[model samples]
Target: MNKLTTLNDHYALYVDGSCLENRDVSATTPAAWSLVIVTGDNGLGKGSGEILEETWGSVITDSSDSAFIGAEVGSNNTAELTAIAEALRWLLIDGGNRPAIVHTDSQYAGNLATGNWKAKANKQLVAMVQKLWREVGALRELNWSHVRAHRGHRWNERADHLANRCVNNQAPMPLSFWKPGQR
Candidate 1:
């Protein structure tokens, strides 16, 4: 019966879910990348009471391009994080920029993004995200933030939809969503 409506609520969800990354985020760089992750059960409603509940999860990643890129129905946190990180990588390299912000619906993934925390629950996915983060850093801007699910935020909602597509294996491949004429 919880409905997310504000950034504070999203932050609260991350804190309450043991989902927030537990790492040291004191490093500073001259890049600006904003990542907003949206994770939660698929088919979840906004406290409508009549909506059915589903146990599916998804995540979205976007940069300044305004294009939607993400995945859905992750088998676990690792899978979801990997999907999101990969999407960011493609976007950054193709977008031709430095220092990028990465958004995710997963606190676990967020932790890995900033190195404020390490991936313990899902080692493989964590490794994947770590690799992608490094690659993105080598290319352009990289920022990390966690967005609460079903919060109704424009980017977050889009991410949620994209993530759902990913979880369902319905998302377009990274290359498919890539913008043309950008190496």
Candidate 2:
């Protein structure tokens, strides 16, 4: 497998989105995004490497409170896309040049950000994510990979937990407070 296919020898960022009521999502829907950055060799594996940072927040509108007023609506896909965008933004600020890889369980997010699929909805959000992807790529080596969700992947699971915590209006857990395989 190519380097992109493998999780070793690179900084890995695992991101996830959570929406408790995804069927009929709206501006008031309980949705959030979270990302976990890992460092060291074989960082993707369970109980290995260090949890460098864990960040999460609720999905809210840009300005207007009304979803009908061109404000962002909270949904699973939007949360997922937002997670990727926020991850890229984090990298731009602190990622340095360490060949980084972003792992997500949402193929919709991975494909759309990588331009492998066209976005029929959420055009504004998708465009923003694509722009961040390009800007990050211009600075360093960046790659995006899709992982199966809720399949016992360590960092992915942690990201899911964090996102859900935000959806439930809980505070983010500190980086030093969590270790690999804690949950």
User: Among these predicted structures, which one has the highest TM-score?
Assistant: 2
Question: For model 2, what is the alpha-carbon lDDT of residue 102?
Answer: 89
Q: Could you tell me every candidate's TM-score relative to the true structure?
A: 0.47, 0.85
**Can you write out model 2's per-residue Cα lDDT over 109-168, one digit (the tens) per residue?**
999988889999888888888988999988888888887887777788789889987888
Score candidate 1 by TM-score against the native: 0.47
lDDT of 1 at 91: 54
Q: Which stretches of candidate 2 lie over 4 Å from their true place?
A: 1-9, 41-44, 64-71, 172-183
lDDT of 1 by residue, 40-115 (tens): 3222322211211111232322223242232221233534454455555555545655333444566766776557
Cα RMSDs, all models: 15.2, 3.7
Clashing pairs in 2: none
- Kindly give the stretch of ten consecutive residues in candidate 2 with the minimal lDDT sum: 62-71
* lDDT of residue 122 for candidate 1: 49
